[model samples]
Target: MGLIITFLAAAFLIAGVVRGSFVNKRANEELPFPTPVSQEVEGSTDDRDVPYYDDDKEEDEVIETITPFIPTPTVSDSQTSDSSATNAYIYPNSTVLSTTANSIELSSTSDPGDITNWYKKLFEEKHFKARSFAQTNTNGHVLNKLAGAGGSLDLEVEIEKKPNEKITVIKVTY
Candidate 1:
């Protein structure tokens, strides 16, 4: 009786295991398979039917066909002509050694007795002839009567003359 009971219990356990495995297999096989949509089908269904464009478009499509990257040549200051017709004059003995946008450099062979005389000649030559000399120092001289009589009389001077060789470097600003 004991042997029969044990055999019956073992058979019942095997039957339950077999039934559970069969049901699991059937459920796996009957599962609804997901359908894969092709690229063409997905694109056609989209609201924007046009194909997606990457950065790999043709040269013509990627760049503007009409206008290309054209480099423009630059014009230099030497090539441009002076627009103003007004002319300036330098004394026959005097020559403009160099010039800049802000100042004019002049050299002369005349004897500048003192800073006062040197400043006077410089002022007169620069169209400040109507003005009078004001003061003088070891460095430079000043003009008392302004060129624009009532306005400002701003001047700066630098001398680079050797005793034997007569030359002067006068810098003026107004």
Candidate 2:
């Protein structure tokens, strides 16, 4: 039994030494050798022989042929005239409350209902208050009305004209 064990140990040691020597010799080659070409490269033809950019000029010509069209915004006098007419109707009896491209200010002796009634009569759509109306007594009149009771009574309404150039309706709650 002792002899068999000793023989097996000697065999393993010899195998290990052989493997280590083989690896070391392979890793320590002295030649500064060039890398071997892969099989794909060895069998390939010259790339320049075929036209790689054959479609490049054609592609540029195609792009040039496509002229980009940018449409300009045309403001018709009729539209402006219509907008002014609508504006005039919105604050017929009221004082020049405030006026801007996007907003209007009016001071009137009438109640909030009167203001709403005017809007309802002029525009097909309903206009509601965006925020509480702030109450101010400018010459004995409520300046702006918020949408509902206890909301601001003084109103600064934001009016937006839709892309179709039609007026968008807003309601004030006060």
Candidate 3:
């Protein structure tokens, strides 16, 4: 048994040495000539990939911000009754942030499980056709279509929660 163990140890050492050369990556080599001029350099205009650019030829940029088709329910004079209750956000102490590109970010103190169920019920009640709703751990993906903007909008609602924290964040990408 001692002889067999000694032989096995010797075989493993040789195998490891042989594997090292095969798995090791090549070392970085210095360039034979200077680096290409197109590469980014400090205080160089080469970053734009053009030798020269005329300020007079620049075009004006116009950005059109999109608005969400579905607005959150609010108490109004016309909706003073039961309809206001349906439009109001159900999660207490939650904030929804609206971005310039029609994206919505929501943060709440509720758990991911509760948020998922609330959204599922909300979308279903609003007659939004759900294409996919998947949940794993604290991550969720919800794809639904509103009454409008189905032709051009690639809308997505994503939910993520960090471990060892009570905050769950949701993002709506439109």
Per-residue lDDT for 56 in model 3?
A: 46
TM-score of each: 0.31, 0.27, 0.37
lDDT of 3 by residue, 114-136 (tens): 77676666556555553457666
- Give the least accurate 10-residue stretch of model 2, judged by summed lDDT: 55-64
Once fitted onto the true fold, the runs of candidate 1 whose alpha carbons sit more than 4 angstroms away are: 1-62, 65-89, 113-162
Comparing 2 and 3 on TM-score, the stronger one: 3
Against the true structure, candidate 1 reaches a TM-score of 0.31
Q: Give the least accurate 10-residue stretch of model 1, judged by summed lDDT.
A: 142-151
Local distance difference test, each candidate: 0.49, 0.46, 0.56
Listed per candidate, the RMSD to the true structure in angstroms reads 26.4, 20.9, 23.6
Put the candidates in lDDT order, highest first: 3, 1, 2
Q: After aligning candidate 2 to the native by TM-score, how far in Å is the CA of 28 from where it should be?
A: 72
Off by over 4 Å in 3: 1-92, 138-155
Clash count for each candidate, listed in order shown: 0, 29, 1
